[model samples]
Target chain A: MASFLRKNRPLLVTLLIVAAVLLWMTNRYEPKVTASILLSGLTLGALYFLVASGLSLIFGLMDVLNFAHGTLFMIGAYIGFTAYANPRLILNTLPFALALLGGAQAGRWLGGLLPARFKQRWQDSSFLVLTFLLALALLFIGVRGFNLEKLVAATATATGGVVATDLAQEAAGRFLPRIILLAVSGLFLGLGLSRVGTAEVRQRPRWTSAGVGLILVAAAFALIPIRTPGEVFLLSVSSNVRFVLALVIGLLAGAGLGALIESSLIRPLYGRVYYQLLLTLGLSYVGGELVKSVWGTVGFYMDIPAFFGGSGDNCPSPNLWSWFSDHCQSINVLGRPFPSYRLFIIALGLAMFIAIALLLQRTRLGIIIRAGVQDSEMVQALGINVRRVFTLVFAIGCGLAAVGGVAAAPFLGVNLGLGLEVQLQGFIAVVIGGMGNYVGSAVGALLVGLARAFGDQLVLSGIHLPWMDGVVRMSPSIARASTVLIMALVLLLRPAGLFGKKD
Target chain B: MTNILEVNAIHTFIGQFHILEGVSLTVPQGSITALLGRNGAGKTTTLRSIMGLNPPREGTILYAGEPIQGKTAYQIATRGIGYVPEYRAIFRALTVEENLRIAERSKGDLAKRGDLIFELFPDLKRFYRLPGGQLSGGQQQMLAIARALVPENQLLLVDEPSEGLAPIIIEAIVAALRQLAAHATVLLVEQNFRMASQLADRYYIVDDGQTVSSGQMADLVKDRPLIAKYLGAGYAGAGLVPAQSTTA
Candidate 1:
């Protein structure tokens, strides 16, 4: 059948088109179902992109599997939180930027701090021992300083800023350097955009700067004092208060730092190693250790202040969550009102998705990245600074992850392991999408996400099987199983990935 | 008249097995010099050590009077020295254009020099768009040499340049070597004696990891009968080599 379909290309195409349309019609949506599916998929897919990208590059370029990449994603988020909350640290936009930069620099310096002979001999596998040893040492230290009593919480930002979606309270004269938040967001965008092989960038962004710029601003706002319209700025920060600017700054800083790391440490370090895949394991462990050092494993999500922050969950949120539970004004369209929360989240995700798509498709950086994905050695040979492009690609990937982290924080629990599970999925998505193809990854993510959602959701309540694993009772989503299935299918059918040219 | 490169009494070891023991050779400016040796006699290993792809345990490899015994291949390349390794290390996954690009880092533009290389091997020009891997052995060898060329190349270390080339291709290579000698210096390690004899200005022979013969290419020509005695070929009757040359 496979050979027949392959030979009869036009017949195959017609059958595929018919099947797609039929499937689409069968899965028609009401707002709530659509939105819930969309939200989970976006957050999940974004997380995968974040973790898998690093893993892929580590393996694809260097050939390192990095069994520990999940740990690194967790670590980066923790670092973002710690940098935001800690005192006597670099404050404000610029300072926050520096802290993130420092973290990444530290990762690189530590990652590369290996003996010459060992590095030459072990190559990528070399990092496994060197980094694992360093991580184990740090782990020993961590156990001494902060004992592991795991506190499980969703969306726990490091500074203890709990997710509260009350628009009225948020605007009720709590924090006003709205420009700073905008600046931080702008900086996040900039950090994401500034990557040499940027997918797409705003030509004249209102708030576009490096992580350092955002950090300095966050610090200045926190420490320097800002007297804006009906807003009180305090020097002594509260134990359970929200540093809105800090989170924003942290995102920007983390993004930039991630970029620098991609270039200075990753490219050169892996260049020496023989099997690039093992780089992931080293990077993951290093990331885990770094996170453990900063946050000490007790996740915190507290309130910043009532005026600049929301007093309660009832207060309503301007962020997507609020737009969902409170803000989305229900309207009668065709005499039926759709579930508002699902619609808003879905829309927000769609907008971001479209924007990302355009960024990858319609920009010069995107073109180079897409091309470089297939042929990096050639790109360098063409007088393009391939090293710089690699760094930028990494930064952009990190920045996207950060954005997804913040946006999805309200929906899922934001803890160390948030990016971990999805990281592997990202690899699967990229692989299923055909390793380096951007459009293919997106489609693959959605397909995988939807499949998982369906697998988890679809159930015959009336019929009960007495003997089944706990997962069946706990909603067995294909999310966990889908990756392996997809990978196996790809291996058997399209080993090169969906969009990949056969090597 | 000036020695571009000089290796003096170099000794190399690969895990205790001594290779290139007491080996010495010199490369003169704007001229071809051949380092001839049997398999496992450490000709390729010497080139690798010179490029810092391998470090020698004992010896001095001096390039332009600067002792460059320990430098990375990239660093060695940037220092006006291009090594066309014996294996033809053309980045297999990369296209011909990309292969040229990675090797394109001289003061002058690499594009202009590429033109001259293609002119020497017009077959490469005809299939310039193809991937380096797709090219035939001779084409890859040509691309490999073309990859090493620069407008003001201080020195070129070519390993087994004519090893597998056809007679016609070998002629083209010899002609190109002569042309390159009009400008850049060359250190050739050749297996084809005829090819080396036509192009080399000086010859150094290594037997069992030790230098056995050293003289001008012109001098070796007059002592043609000695090839059978020393190298086990060419010389007709007497076992001893004769010292005779038009220059002398």
Candidate 2:
């Protein structure tokens, strides 16, 4: 009996703490309210797990503390929102894609024309600078020549002298010639830029990337005729299909951006911890600003998909079985009503957890990753390219963050502050769970989630003791600070974190 | 025998400190060549330089008659060179099977050579499912060598394989290396002069990051003054030098 107790002491202690918390909760509040709070806490925990798991994995394998992780989350939300509601915005933005590709190619071409000595000295930096200047020039031309407000007003005057949101279609049609000219100039810019970097010219010309740029230019022209206003096309598709599409697109965009960032920014700065931190922090700021520039500063809530019974004030049925047939916004859980979308969030988190666990435990890639965490240099010497694995892990981490963002859209609403808010929570969870420990992050997230929920409830309803006459209330800020307090407590007791190995 | 690997005046650095300055050596095909040096004499660094873990900034490394100095570690490994790093740098968290699995350069290489590996160290077959960390020091060394043999490597860089093992374990490792030397050329780094004299056909003495002497192992065993000067009198006094110089 003693041996068994000694073996399972950590597990037994955790259970005891949970039981004590439950006993106190049942003493102070109604069972239904407690149950409702528990459900909400789990939902919040699920979101935290999605964000924290990726952060932990990235840090574990690559030793990169990615500040831009939250930005990837925010980007996911915006991408999801566009795919669901304003998909026309994506179609209208084709010219920018063309411009970017054209500008890059032009930068490369222009860089190739520089003297060999200068090219050899500057290398990648020269091409980067050339591309940046060309991009700025293109942005200037876009803002000056095709200002949206001016075009709207001019189109209104040409049509009937009254402004309307749908008037963007006619305005865009009128500037078709100018749009074509911009695309052509972008292609020319790319060709010119390609010449300024001599290494690319000395090495073989990038026929494949150049071909992709040409295809984008062709696509820009093809897509111009079908450009419609964003809101007008919203009613054509089912919300369920749109939501699924949003999720897939959000995941893909997140992964693509992650790969791009790791290869272009983080790859060059490997082993330089401070530079990586600074670069990622700067990227987060720039990303948030970019989102604001495109999507505006105001926060917006996504419409709940019809499969989750759509949005409403009250649920029609309290029966659990009615969930299948009825279009209810809320489901009854333990006789307490809860948002059905939050339940879906909980399910998504569990599924992600299982998938990641299986990936780490069952696959050859998992073996490589596990070994990499100990000594990446050794793994590299063992005939595995650890650098490629680092990039893949980074992309996967970012993709998971984006998944969390898209999932959080309906529950918490999409906003600029959402990135920083979740990022702080994720960092706390990672620290409490133990840095780079995957399962620990999930457990830490749950603890933080539950503490926050109970703290909020305590602030709102106050706690009444058997000996005390009335309820003792505390400030709401305590609830906000609960996660940090837990983190501090965990650090004090177990310095390496709950599961972190002593180095 | 023809030389399979040749490193010429190679200079390697770890961070800012120059670890391998003007170090050079050669390994003959199908033979065990011993690199004898004291602790902190850049013996391990020389092995690392050949493996491309810390590639040399100067001079050339010719592997089977092709330059391989500037190549990355994985590239060097893929070119048929295997390394068993010092301290048995096995992935502690990985199972024995998983450790060997990761070392396979091509698919099914492990299964194809499973018989040979099991024949070499039978204990590994018994503990295949266990994590590498759970193994004893000697067992871990066996697993490390087993990992290097998984791929069809032409040359093996084995570093101090008997450093922390018991005498009995060292004898077992020596026996295993004798069997392995028939299949692949080995460049061994050993502090134990006795083991070096037993297993090596040729020897090179490195001091202060440069090769100071080279000759047949029989000659190294006979020369008492040379052994005392380079390997320290402690090694000579410890009876590491064999009494019978004509044994080899």
Best by DockQ: 2
What is model 2's native contact fraction?
Answer: 0.76
Candidate 1 share of real interface contacts: 0.02
Q: lDDT per model, in order?
A: 0.54, 0.80
**Pick by TM-score: which candidate is best?**
2
Evaluate fnat for each of the predicted models and list the values in order: 0.02, 0.76
Runs of candidate 2 with Cα error greater than 4 angstroms are A1-12, A94-235, A310-316, B238-248
> Residue by residue across A1-503, what tens digits does model 2's lDDT show?
99998755544665687689978888777898888778878988898898899999999999999999999999998878766665655555645565555445444445455686765555445664664566567556654545444332332132222234454444565546655556655654554444442221122235565666567666666666656523345436678888888888888878878987886578768789999999999999999999887777777778888888644554744755777677688887767778888888999999999999998989988989999988998898888988779889899899989989998998888889988888888889899888999988898888778877888888999877779999898999898798899889888987867767778
User: Which regions of candidate 1 are displaced past 4 Å?
Assistant: A1-43, A79-286, A289-293, A296-411, A429-477, A492-503, B13-17, B92-95, B106-108, B111-115, B123-129, B218-248
lDDT string for model 1 (B1-248, tens) is 88989888888777688887878888888878987755676788777667666567678988999987754454456678777777665655456665565555543456768667777778877876687778988888877777777434588889998776777766677777777777688888877666677678888888777888988877776675556545556322221233223112
* Model 1 docking tier (incorrect/acceptable/medium/high): incorrect
lDDT of 1 by residue, A1-503 (tens): 88886655533453475368336534654555544454455545554554444445434443434454455455445544443343212222232233333333333333244355754454435444444355444334323422122221212332333222122122213333333333333332323222212111111122223333545455544542322211212224553243444345445654665665555345545444544446545666677666555445655543322232333444334344443345433322333433333343345445555775675556545544544665554333233455556666666556555544443333454466666666767677777766655555665665566555544444312223448544344435444785578668766776777665577
